[model samples]
Target: MNFDSYASDVMAATVEAVNQLTPGHARGRDYPAARPDLGDLVGEAAVSSEDVDELRAYAFKIREIFVAVDDNRIDDACEATNTLLAETQAAPTLSRHGGEPWHLHFHTPSERWARGWAAPMATALAIVLGNPMHDRLGVCTATVCDRVFVDVSRNGTKRYCSTACQNRVKAAAFRARKQV
Candidate 1:
């Protein structure tokens, strides 16, 4: 299930950024009002207020992709992905930062959060579309929970974010079958 090393890193970072931007327990904090750290990832490009708005929209779009996948609505997921892909222009290159080795990268020179996110996200989608890994994008199966994950596992079999959620789902299912 390994993609190209650089693509894997970029996808990993993309997932992290999505999690950071989205409200969730995994982050251990509420979503920030201002994410200066996002600017670092996007580079020194000009980011407008509109760009931030758009980024939020796209974050929700990513959320929709997860929900659609959970519902087994592949058409909706594909449509959402196409919308994101249309908004992005990802080109791959190599760069070094934070003492990390040179790696495959994709970006635009915009400082705006949404614009900055577009390229990397688009690149991640490209990897997913090109490889079997695309099926890995999914939502948690726990009842009353809606978290997303990119299951980059050898078995393509990740169903929940934590054991707690797994147990919750199992318990719920057991109760449902008993009532039936």
Candidate 2:
């Protein structure tokens, strides 16, 4: 359970998935057709429409963690994460399967995609929150996007979800200056 790598990878992907897959106003991706990362996170399980529905709801819950972190409410984020962990029954188990090296997994081997994901997402977030890296989780500052991101930079100054969003904000500022 390396919190840095685990949170940067798994939790990052899950947060991005929530931004993409969650129902909302015109996010820029064709979520179902474009999300191969979701498949990777769920391992061999297929994602169904029902799973998407579940994830859409779950996205709101996950957002609470990010929002709490963003608002400097670490305890609120922890409480929310604790509830999710309890609900998901997260357990850390290590095993080597499919010829891969032994690594940690949070859900039972047979858990459904949504439930399975809930456990690890919560666990990864918990790892981050418990450590000094709790501030690593953030919501994008871009006006058009509410995507979450993990700040993995050396200086930890990251503020947007992606370079595109960063550029968008910069360009918007430039346009505003030009208009003025």
Candidate 3:
């Protein structure tokens, strides 16, 4: 099966959800506006404000996984992910929907909004951490940003979460050089 697509897509959505749903530099942003993209992770699932709040709590847990990885605490990351996997009761299943071809999915018995999304996300993350490419997951290195990302670049050298953050750092360095 296409594990790469699963890992990349879920991880990207995880990043978006965490950045938009949780507080930090991206706090003041609108989660509702970002729902379209986030919806890819949970198709057609109904979510309410209380559901969003639960998701916001899940966001914090996901962020901890990224922080552990970024901090070079691989064991901690794995343990945290394992805890989430157990909590969410994530299990693999074959699902075909919307006339799409049959493919793999991680499912949880709980119909709760947070666990619904958390199961697949945690499953994708477990797949990565179980492999050598676990380092591909990371929290943005920008001091001003706590965003998380999956480094899918060919060289796997990504540090910043986005080009905007990369450019901001570059511009700051240029200004510093001029002053020096």
Best by TM-score: 3
Candidate 2 — number of clashing residue pairs?
0
TM-score of 1: 0.65
lDDT of each: 0.65, 0.77, 0.77
Q: TM-score, each model?
A: 0.65, 0.84, 0.85
The C-alpha local distance difference test score for the whole of candidate 1 amounts to 0.65
Model 3 C-alpha lDDT versus the unseen true structure: 0.77
Q: Please write out the lDDT profile of model 3 over residues 8-60, one tens digit for every residue.
A: 77877788787777666532222343442455545677777777777778888
Question: Better model by TM-score, 1 or 2?
Answer: 2
Residues 54-130 of candidate 1 have per-residue lDDT tens digits of 76666766777767766777777777777777776566667777799976656643334665566777666666655
List the candidate 1 regions with Cα displacement exceeding 4 Å. 23-54, 93-102, 110-113, 170-180
Candidate 2, residue 177: lDDT: 100
- In terms of lDDT, the poorest run of 10 residues in model 3 is 27-36
In the range 61-146, model 2's lDDT, one tens digit per residue, is 88889889999999999999999899889998886778899888898878777877778888888889999878988888877567
